[model samples]
Target: MDKLTIIKIIHTVIWVFFNVVLFYLLYSVLINKIDKWVWICIGLILMEGLVLLLFKRMCPITVIARKYSDSTKDNFDIFLPNWLAKHNKLIYTTFFVPILILLIYRLISG
Candidate 1:
């Protein structure tokens, strides 16, 4: 309906897209289907990490969303629960790193 709302919606879409890609990469690694797509997914995630760093450890979308509304709700920018959204990076990295490391080890040893 408004510019900020549209931007918030776009931000949420991108946030969801990032998680979808991350999960798909995880699925590929777990299924032993790591291939070019997996590398591409990793690259995407790295770029996201870079963006996070650039934004002072906040997602660019989240920063942009701050200008839109001051809802202060966890799901304001993304579709995650309050607690999960707050700890998304830590939780995902905890799981993602080990799996990715194991997959990379398998790749390297093969």
Candidate 2:
């Protein structure tokens, strides 16, 4: 594997890892797991979203990957399915937003 391929693999691994943590934290929030840890996770998620939003919703690794290759194929930097790669944010946000809202309610009420 070349440097670009190695970087792509690292990017894919990090992306998947973050997603797993996000889902786990979101699940914890849904199950009424209220505490500093939940809030910390929420903060991390929001911060990450803000950073991505600043970059037009593209991961920094995606920008770097473009410099290495001109492939327009889906899953260029990740090992995800084409559909999942395309709709991952929409899919996760579907659950995350509401759970976040509930988290806020819990925080405010307590």
Each model's Cα RMSD: 1.9, 1.9
Q: Ten-residue segment with the worst summed lDDT in candidate 1?
A: 72-81
Residue-level lDDT of model 1, residues 1-110, one tens digit each, is: 87666776786678778778888887887788878988888888888888888889887777777777788776677656789878888987787787689788779977
Task: State how far residue 89 of model 2 sits from its true place (Å).
Answer: 2.0
Candidate 2, which segments miss by more than 4 Å at Cα?
108-110
lDDT values of the candidates? Answer: 0.79, 0.77
Q: Return the clash pairs for model 2, or none.
A: none
lDDT of 2: 0.77
Q: Candidate 1, residue 102: CA error in Å?
A: 1.8
Q: Please give the RMSD of candidate 2 to the true structure.
A: 1.9
Model 2 lowest lDDT segment of ten: 21-30
Summed over model 1, clashes come to 0
